[model samples]
Target chain A: MAKELLKGNVAMAEAAVRAGCEAYFGYPITPQTELLEHMAARMPELGRAFVQAESEVAAINMVYGAACTGKRVMTTSSSPGVSLMMEGISYIAGTEVPMVLIDVMRGGPGLGNIAPAQGDYTQMVHGGGHGDYKTIVLAPASVQEAIDLTALAFDLADKYRAIVVVLADGSLGQMMEPAELPEMQPLKKQLPDWAITGEPGRDRRLLTSIYLQPEDEETTNIRLQRRWMEIEANEVRYQEYFLDDAEIVLVGFGTAGRVALSAIRHARAEGIKVGLFRPVSLSPFPAEALRLVARKAKAMLVVEMNAGQMLNDVRLVTQGACPVDFYGRMGGVVPLPDEILSEIMRLARFTPHDLNGHTRAAWLDRLEVVRGAK
Target chain B: MVATDIQNAKLVYERPESLADVATHYCPGCTHGTAHRLVAEVLDEMGIREHSIGVASVGCSVFSYNYFDMDFVQAAHGRAPAMATGVKRVFPDRTVFTYQGDGDLASIGMAEIMHAAARGENITVIFINNAIYGMTGGQMAPTTLPGMKTTSSPRGRDVETQGYPIRMSEILATLDGVSYVVRRSLHNPAEIRKSKKAIRYAFETQQRGLGFSMVELLSSCPTNWGMTPLDSLTFIEDKMVPAFPLGDYKVIDAVKSMKWKEG
Candidate 1:
């Protein structure tokens, strides 16, 4: 297919449809609304299901129900809306039904503005919902990558019977980029044995999260843990740029990662020996890769659109092998290439005390000094 | 009782094929079993066991999926209607219904059920209104009467403090999307039969693409009500019925004009 200029949200919606999404249930939330709107237009024309639910709570439950039928189903929302969906998300996760979710993240702990932020890094990658279940979290840095990851989300969801989240920020959702759309996949003719398809002749099927029995729930949890172990072993994905002979490493994901990539190129030109390590699978955290990067590099700077949420994970993986630093923009602020470039420049002139656990606090202190800047 | 003559004799009564052979977890004398039997019988009679999908809402009825011989999904508290909407929209030809209790339907799930009725999603809701939370042990439900007393409202439900009961059938009947809305009871055999008939009519309405349908069965929670089985039934007749009247609140013209014989 020829590359077409497409907005991230629209491209993702079309990608999901082409990926054989049989149903979509979502409410209007900024940045992610375009995805739902596109599905509203496309799904019906495709003779599939589309429901604009009353709330994100309803939308996620609807997604949960459709997922029970062993069909490729999806729902999209921004941060606050995704917060409302946590209850149903936990249910869907606990039930072990497969579904795709796109979180075009915007700001805040409250009803933050509709601008871009990586605030949901901990929430989506780490379990925001209750209990012991892991969602496959994919962070796509560009519109094209968003389209590719959107298609991948469905396959990963069905393959592991897991919830696969495409975590994008507002800028990625709104930005237009040239991307080739994948050919439409044919819907499945055969339903999975566990699918609740209302077929009478087959032994009846059920989809539920409730394991009232303590031992039974434990067994199920262990099974989920084992599946997650398999996922961690097989599905770790990351992109490394100029890491072969580098001392300063920049770590980020999604938009922040892309911005760092630009900074790395500029920093390398300045003889900073800076490299970019961008994790694509945010959940499985590319721990070993980061550990490897940490062993070789003197310092690492983690960049994000939030108050360094992913930094916590980076620290855990690095395990004090090397000093780590943080730079972030909170509440709808999108970090620019120059801002990261400066952070990388700062890392080049780094002193031993500069890259400590107090890294976030010192950055926040400096951040408050400015009125509004990325 | 002679097995020798059983082959020649007529079987007067038997468990509905839609119901599992095992015993239910419902407390002895609770009307949830009766309500489940009514729904199961209706599904079996209508021959939709194979084509049906049941959403079991949280509460005593949450285990309804285990009892019904149909594709089922247990929903989060009060989210059954939304789940049913998802299932029904995906499989338009499938018969989808939600079996929810008073607390599940009237309290936490008020928004979901109201909106499902408002959308007229061509699904049936079998709402069991026992006026108190049975699963959680005597908590006051939204349908709990003004003066009714339970564990949560042990001093009696004060209209001044807790407010009056909500008539869901009447409330849902006002929506344009709703095709059939009826309130029935299981206090007596006659009412049980009528409830079954209404359940049938509700499903038939859905089958005919007549939009949303519901049968609110005024059930009894003897253990939670702190009364004997008979006294609980009497309480439902005396106090509950007056608060939540049993009648057809809304029978859309299409449903009213159309003939539906009990299968």
Candidate 2:
């Protein structure tokens, strides 16, 4: 296949079509509108359905309905729109529907801003919807990665009988990079037997979330919890950069991880043995992967677009194995490599405090309002 | 006891293989059973039971999924119409319909139901209007008559405070995409027969690829109304019928082609 420059969002749409997704339903939101626009142009040509729904709520239900028929389906939105879809997402998860949701995240507590942010990390990984269901959250860093992971998302969604979220951000959504478009994988020979297309002289099929009995709820929750544990055990993914001989390591994801990789290269140029731990799976948090990096490094710097949201997860997995410091730039600003390198130097020289010791009341108070809205 | 049991026997009910054999969970003498029977009979008569998909909403009628033999998907309160739109759009050849209550369709799902009608989604909706939230223990519904008393309105619904009841069929008939809109009641045997015809019209319209079809059946909730089953039917005939008149509000079948427009 010939390689070409493609924005991450467009690449994702192409990959979704190639993956045999027959429907794309979404409401336009910033940084991710290109994805829906691409599908609107391409899906019709592919003999598929493309709908710009009246709202995110409607868009997700469209996905739910199409998925109920066992058709390959998807929808894309940004942060605030994704928030509006959480109720539907939870329903989809509870019902065990196979569909893909792409969140090109933006800064938010409210309509925070239409810029990149990693603020949705906890929401994505810790079951952004509700119930004990888990969505396999794939974090893509580049246009090619976005394309590849979107293809992977469908496979994972169908295989696991779960919703799969492709967690990218505005920069990755907008940035163009050279991507080698893979040949479309042939559609699966069969869909899940539970999907309800029509009766067709067979027993009627139902795709629903309601289980009226209390014991049914208990059984489903237990089954979902075990499935999540299995995913955590098997699907952890990460990229190790210069951790062979290093005293300090940087941990980040999505575009922030790419920025951190550049920062690590810069720090190495100055003989600062700072490595990078870039995660490909935002959910399942790559716990063991971070543990391995923490064991080899003296301290870790966690960089993100939100006020240290992923920091809590990192600390939970690492368990104070090494001091973890956070450098966050919220409300659409991505921290520059120069700024991150300076933070690396400060971590190397100054005795690092626990990440919690540095909370600014101004930001914390603002986050309080965001929390209430949720 | 024998006389009471005999009196409770329903003469209007038909034994349909497509419907569950169990007694309905609806309160005795409740018109929901009558409305459901009408809808079920229509599905069976059209021989579309094999191709039908029903979406159940939040109310006493939410258990509609359990009664229909067709594939059923229970949706969030008031969102069944939107969900049904998605289902119908995905499987355009299939018969998709929503069974919703006044609270679900006229109140919380107002935007969803209205937009689906406006989009002319080829799906039928069987709306059961009991004028109160039956499942939630008789709270006031959007269609509850202005002076009707409910758990939420102990002193009777205040017209000055809460305004008037919403007439959904009247509101829906104004939309150009709506192919058929009818309001029927299940209080009497004659009304029951008319309700079945209304439901049949809705299904037939969708089969013809006409736009949205709706049959709003003015139903009775004996438990919620704090009345016996027989009294509930009387209440529907006396109280509800006067407020929500029985008649076809709109019927525009686009599939009937015009010879002058065609070659």
Candidate 3:
């Protein structure tokens, strides 16, 4: 298909449709409303199911319902709305219903403003809902990535029989870019054997998350853990940029990762060895990849539009092989490329010679100064 | 002698084919089993049992899926209507219905049920209003009458403090999207028969492509009500009916002119 200038939200919505989403249920929340609006206008014309649910809670449950029929279903929301959907999402996870969810995230902690932020990194990666379950969390950094990832989300959801989340920030949701839309895939006409699609030529089917017995619930939890482990083994995704000869690395994802790429290019032009390690899947987080990068780099700077959420994961993977630093701007503040470039420059100054001299203590004192200022 | 007489007698009360042969988990004298039987009979009579999809709501009827011999999806508390809406919208040719409780429909799920009705979703809703939350032990439900003492309302449901009981059928009937809305009791055989007819009419409305149809049956939660099954039947007739009148709240012209057909 020809490339079209599309907003990220609209592109993702169209991509989901092309990916053969059979049903969409969502309420209007800023940053992500356009996706819901696009689906509203297009789904009915395509003869698919669409509902402007009364609330985010209702929308997710509707997706849960449609998913039970073994159909490709999805719902989208922003921060607070996603919080409202946690209960339904947990239920979908517990029942092992395959569906896609798009979280075009805005600022959080409350009814925060609708500006771009990577505040939901922990929530998405660590399972926001109640219970020990995991969702396939895909962080898309651009309009094109959003479109591609939203389509891939459905396939992954079905493959794992689990919820797949496309976690993008407000800027990615609102920005316009040229995207080559994928060709439409035909919808599946026959329901899967596990689907609850009326009982003719089959035994009666029931789909639920409830397990009254403790042992039964434990068995289900174990099965879910095994599936998650399998996903972790096979579905870890990341993008490496200019890492072949680099000594310093910039780690980020989503909008921040995109921003860090510009910083890395700027740093490279200045003769500073900085590369970018962008995680595409935040849940099965590219820990192994980061471990490899950590061994090659002298220092790593984790950039985010939140107060160092993904930094914790980066630190764990790096395991002190190299010093990992964090630069974040929270509450809807998008980190500037120059700011990240400066952080990269600061990391570059921590050479082996400087580590053995007063320059090391000076850098430590400067870090203390920075922390005190915050 | 009785066995010899039985061999010569006709069996008039065999279980409905649409009903699964599993033993119910309902408390003795609870009307959920009766309501389930009515829905199963209606589905069988219409011959839509094979194509019917039931969304079982979270409450006592959460396990209702196991008792019905059709594809069933169990929804989280009060989400049955929203779930049913999805199913019906996706498979418009198939029959879809939600079985919900008073707490599930009138309390936490109030928005889902109301919007589904207001949107005119082509589905049937079987609401059992037993004036208490049965599944979670006797707590005050949205339909709990004033001065009714339960676990949560130990001092009796103070009308000033706890608010008035919700008459869901009457409330839902006011919505323009509803094609049929009725409140029936299941306290006696005569009332049970009427309730079944109403259930049939509700399903027929859905089958005829009419808008939202719901039959709110005044059921008895004997264990939760702290009454024997026989006394609970009397409670529905004497106490519940006066508060929630037994009558058709709305019957749109399309539903009134409709005739039930064998699929």
- Expressed as tens digits, the lDDT of each residue in B131-219 for candidate 3 is 99998999999999999999999999999989999999999999999999999999998999999999999999988898899999999
User: Candidate 2 chain A: worst 10 consecutive residues by lDDT?
Assistant: A358-367
lDDT score of residue B121 within candidate 3 = 94
Clashes of each: 0, 0, 0
State residue B190's C-alpha deviation in candidate 2, in Å: 1.1
TM-score for all predictions? 0.98, 0.93, 0.95
What is candidate 1's lDDT per residue for B185-261, written digit by digit as tens? Answer: 99999999999989999998998999999999999988988889999999989988888889999998899887755
Off by over 4 Å in 2: A351-374, B1-14, B253-263
- Model 3 — TM-score against the truth? 0.95
Q: Please state the error at residue A222 of candidate 2 in Å.
A: 0.8
Provide the lowest-lDDT 10-residue window in model 3 chain B.
B254-263
- Candidate 1 matches the true fold with a TM-score of 0.98
Least well predicted 10-residue stretch by lDDT in candidate 2 chain B: B254-263
Residues A26-109, candidate 1: write the lDDT tens digits.
999998888999999999999999999999999999998899989999999999999999999899989999999999999897
Better of 1 and 2 by lDDT: 1
**Candidate 1 wrong stretches, greater than 4 Å:** A351-356, A369-374, B1-7, B260-263
Instruction: Judging by TM-score against the true structure, name the best candidate.
Output: 1
Docking class of 1: high
Query: How large a fraction of the reference contact set does each model reproduce?
Result: 0.78, 0.48, 0.79
